[model samples]
Target: MSDRGRVPGQDYGVKMIPYEDLLKHEPLREFPEIDERTPATLLFTSGTTGPPKGGYHTHRGLVLHTLSTALAVKNPPVNASQDDVAMVLVPMYHVHAWGWPWSTMLNGHRKIVYPGRFDWGHILRVIHEEGVTFSAGVPTILYNLLMHPDSPKYDLSRLKFIVGGAALPEGLLKATQARGMTVISGYGLTETAPVLTIAYLRPEHRDLPAERRNEIYLRTGINIPLVQLRVVDEQDRDVPRDGKTIGEIVVRSPWLFREYIGDPEKTRNAWRNGWFHTGDAAVWYPDGYVKIADRLKDVIKSGGEWIPSLRLEDLISTHPGVNLVAVVGVPHEKWGERPVAIIVPKPGYEGRLTENDIKNHLMQFVEKGEIPKWWIPDKVIFVKELPLTSTGKIDKKVLRDQYKDALPK
Candidate 1:
């Protein structure tokens, strides 16, 4: 294996030890006694919005998270077992790959496959060769896998995917379904030891039709075991479970970081009223499920009304011509900010996907009362490709910066 991302190129003050040389020494005869609250590791945030912040996890927290995550995948629709193999695609440096390195051991998975780098074709080959049955990654990674040229040649029928880092789009979900792969949505953040929710079906709803089932799978999901999640307004009051009232998602979990390392003010602001604020806007439903709208900073303020970028992007992604899409708000004199869609067209669609075509596509949804007519993007710009963050999510911060002044007064 190539030691690209693994090797620290610079001389950092600490000495490095080779695995082979370290094993030559005898094992420790005794272990040191330490409190469970002792810090185990410190991981920095993905920093898609701004500068990365450090969050430390306690030994106790990681243990609980491992158990909780193991339980989550074993419950209901997932029912992960020892027969299953895991190819964890999430970066290990980010939230410890959603705590799977520990959880997989707890779950006693049949095997674990690690792809040193995210070469899509190589991943497909690994999946086929290793008989990989389960995987977890951001939507972008899943997108690349499905769009790969050799995707059809591989048998992904038995594969199950857990998608996080961003909301899963309907089009992508359906495409995966068509390929006989099971995909579920998940939601979390860096500070919470990251596994907040997984969209697994309840026992009662397991017999529902495919369309109904897919709707549930597309949601942000309900709280995982031991995770107390709530959607609250600015006053910190719980929002109604009407599935329309948007509120910030606040969470209380055993594994959450106590503070943002070295940033006291941010730490205080994040953990207010005894909950860690996720800064993600979402809606609560009577079914006890939460559906994310957009990040608080990414929500577009148009004519004093909130236009959720995620919902718009989800709808637009279903268009046949669009391979990848990002909806961002640009400054507008009359409306404060208007949505503009940046798209990457699929092969054979370049230069053919026009603004009018997108507006017309959205109109169908508007007519069905699925989305408000006024929510349509004012402009659509096709791009060769969309920018991605280190964690493989759409880099909305970069998009916003690049198009901050895209609109004319």
Candidate 2:
């Protein structure tokens, strides 16, 4: 097998194995000897908080994750037949891609591996030629495809479904659905072997009103079987399930990773009481669905109150003039930290928005007391585009490093 690294356009420096060689290799006689506690794979955390940590998963854990995710998304004997072909768009190095490759193989599907880097033209061509029925990608990748000037040049009707994550934006989902494609949003982290919950349209919900169904589509989704989830407070106590009470999300699953590699102390802290703590703050709906609000570390703490950065960013992105936006915390003496929004305006719309316009739009929320007056961003930085990570999420660490020192004393 040839081992290569760092292709020109790829971000994560993934190692690619030729499809011909992969087909010729003999299957393993037995699964690797790994206990429930042994490390099967090491996935690095997103590191939006401080530094990336490597979370270790076991062979059994990964298998559980795969089966549960497949069941949640309704990939059954019909849609995902043994003869079905799958073209993976997410890089193999990412948890979404890494976990899916094994899951597809386990289900006996034919896999067409894309070489390093995502070429939109090449991807469309391969799907039609290979008769690819299922695909997995991040929302950013899908957005690029749906907006590509040549998208109509390729026949994509054969695609049955697309599993999107790694920062799924609402507008991206709507755009894909408009093209007669089914888009499923799933939530997970590298630490969990990455498939904890999936947004599936329940059989009963199919007959519901169009507007009601659309509301369900906006939620992150319900938990898959065998995974126990709860929204908790700082004291590790469960929060009310009124669908409005916000708390940190914690999970206990058969597929949970053991701990962060080489950091037992952190591992012990995160896995306290035998439950893996997800630092993401979230809320649960009355119907047992969970919606992630923001990362605890990323939440802006202003004037002894918490502001959900993810919610704010989502709201800002809905504006037609805004292309992309990231909300970051800027140091403050009185409030401890305040929010600053970095915006990339849509083409030809730059310099059209003023600070007053933003405040005016947010004034409606201020009146409802959903947000305080002080929570408004101190300043807005306009840019051509936001820097993204290998997985396509905003690279907040890079932004922090660039602006952390520039914060006012």
Best by lDDT: 1
Residue-by-residue lDDT tens digits, candidate 1, 35-97: 787666667788887898876677888999889889999866678999999987888887899
Which candidate has the top score in TM-score? 1
Task: For candidate 2, report its TM-score.
Answer: 0.81
Local distance difference test scores for all models: 0.88, 0.70
Model 1 collision count: 0
Candidate 1 runs further than 4 Å off:
1-31
TM-scores for all candidates?
A: 0.92, 0.81
lDDT of 1 at 111: 97
